[model samples]
Target: MRRKKLFKMAEVLTFENVFRDPTVIFGKWKEFFGNDNDIVLEVGCGRGEYVIGLSEVYPERNFVGLEMKGSRIWPGAKKMLAEERKNVSFINTMVKNVFDFFGEGELSEIWVTFPDPQPKPCRAMKRLISPRHLEMYKKLLKKGGKLHFKTDNTMLFDYGVEVVGADKDFEVEVVEYDLYSTEDRADLAEAKLVQTYYEGKFSALGEKIKYLRAKI
Candidate 1:
């Protein structure tokens, strides 16, 4: 497994659209994509499912997947390179360093898909939707930009909703404990459109996906 991971890491380094240096593209995302289109970010994008899927759906917009593990990002990065996708890219970095990856008000949307719950009380601040991360999102995302969260863990969902709801800077737009159970509508189309690898596994095991969207 270690050898396979090393190979994937090496292969990811060769992809033209995969970036290792966040400083290089800090405020030049439009120049990198060669367009002034709006950019969206997907945090913890395993295998780039959401990024690839959203790119196909919204070709007019650019999508960037941020994941620290290159092995998990190999399949998606390879597909984007093979297909010559211009609006999709991958960033090899941790979420904690996201503030340095993009300029202020640079992103139009942000997605936190099936992230680790960090359930313990001591680890609560580590969750992607924690108060500290929300502040970072507020700084990087444009005014009124949306932040979407999806997970199979109830505790995390409730915690996220509470935190975002309490923040005066954010307005909670949507909160669904069971995404698919509700009536299908245009507002929920994006979240309904893509199912990440872990999302599929959790759904198969009878877990109801929890989703929340907030505008900052």
Candidate 2:
């Protein structure tokens, strides 16, 4: 029998209602989290592959997947709920307003996976891991916390590395040009993070997966 895809529908509040309005989440972080535990936040968590997988692998650490589209996020949210995963949660919110959802130094780790490349020069600001966004990530991540990134776009991969290198607060520890090579595949299997829908498709197409791990 084929293995079941672990996904479920999720009910989420509006972005403005949850993060912007003080009545919703303000002073209620503990209630949302339910305990004092190390937290990892995954931005642009499409279809919830990586965050859900990581939550299963690391039950002691809480995982929060933030995405703007409720329709795209519901499956992952439902999966976590169906699995009865207490350490995982989902947030439907825009990346531009991430600061509203998280206070300074509030996260143990941050993951940016397969974000839009935004090839046009005019659309450069929209790149998820741009210098401006990296600065914002630095504010929310704890000192020495890790930032993990994976992308199939070569230009975006190079740009991310350049941006991270220019930031004094971040130090790049791992840069893999091809993450799906046989050797690398074996390494990754030992501690598999999570694979998004796009990641699986791209890998099937033989597209190289670039990865970077950095400390802030």
Candidate 3:
């Protein structure tokens, strides 16, 4: 575990990666990934297993996982480094600082998985899928880009859908309240389900997974 912590500390990226001026490097992702390709973000990417899985599946698209906790960011960063996957990277920063790093319409897609619901109404702003965060996502994603959300909490899923539906700019493209019980959702099952370790744990307990896709 000590060795693992050491490695995570080494891989965690900060302002220096973008020359300490995130706003200046906006829309210039090729400088970091070494190629001009679609960029995708996984917000609140705990353990980062799902985003790492996506980097493996979509070699042509660059994937960046934003995680504040170095310990949780370790496994995915270490694995990508060992595999020499240039398309994958991890950013150690707060989600609120996201705009400081990326520019408008710079990202192709975003994935929000198992984020804390911040159940209390007063703390709801802390939720990653809150209305504020959705607006932030709107500016980053390219036209028609999609935002995918998955969670085991029923309350969080319902809240996210309600927020998306109320927003005039976003359209709820898909909804799957019980993923396992649903049938023939090849669109979700085939590629969108980037199941992570946490997901497996919840599934083992027979929890039903909920999902929603919002088009921006």
TM-score of each prediction: 0.97, 0.86, 0.88
Q: List model 1 lDDT by residue over 1-216, tens digit each.
A: 689899999899788899888778788888899999999999999899999999998999999999999988999999998899999999998988887788789999999999899989999998989999999999989988999999999999999999999999999999999999989799999999999999999999999999999998
Provide C-alpha RMSD values for all models, in order.
0.9, 5.5, 3.0
TM-score for predicted model 2 compared with the true structure: 0.86
Q: How do these models rank on lDDT, best leading? A: 1, 3, 2
Output the number of the TM-score-best candidate: 1
lDDT of 3 at 24: 50
lDDT of each: 0.93, 0.77, 0.80
Which candidate has the highest lDDT of all? Answer: 1
Off by over 4 Å in 1: none
Ranking by TM-score: 1, 3, 2
List model 3 lDDT by residue over 65-125, tens digit each.
8887776777667677767888887777789988878888989899998888789999988
Please tell me which model should have the higher TM-score, number 1 or number 2: 1
Query: Number of clashing residue pairs in every model?
Result: 0, 2, 0
Write candidate 2's Cα lDDT for 1-216 as tens digits.
222322222234432212334356645667776888888988998887887888787788888788877667766666666667777777777887777677889899998999989998788788989988998899999998989889989999999999998899999987889875636454355223566898888888989988888998
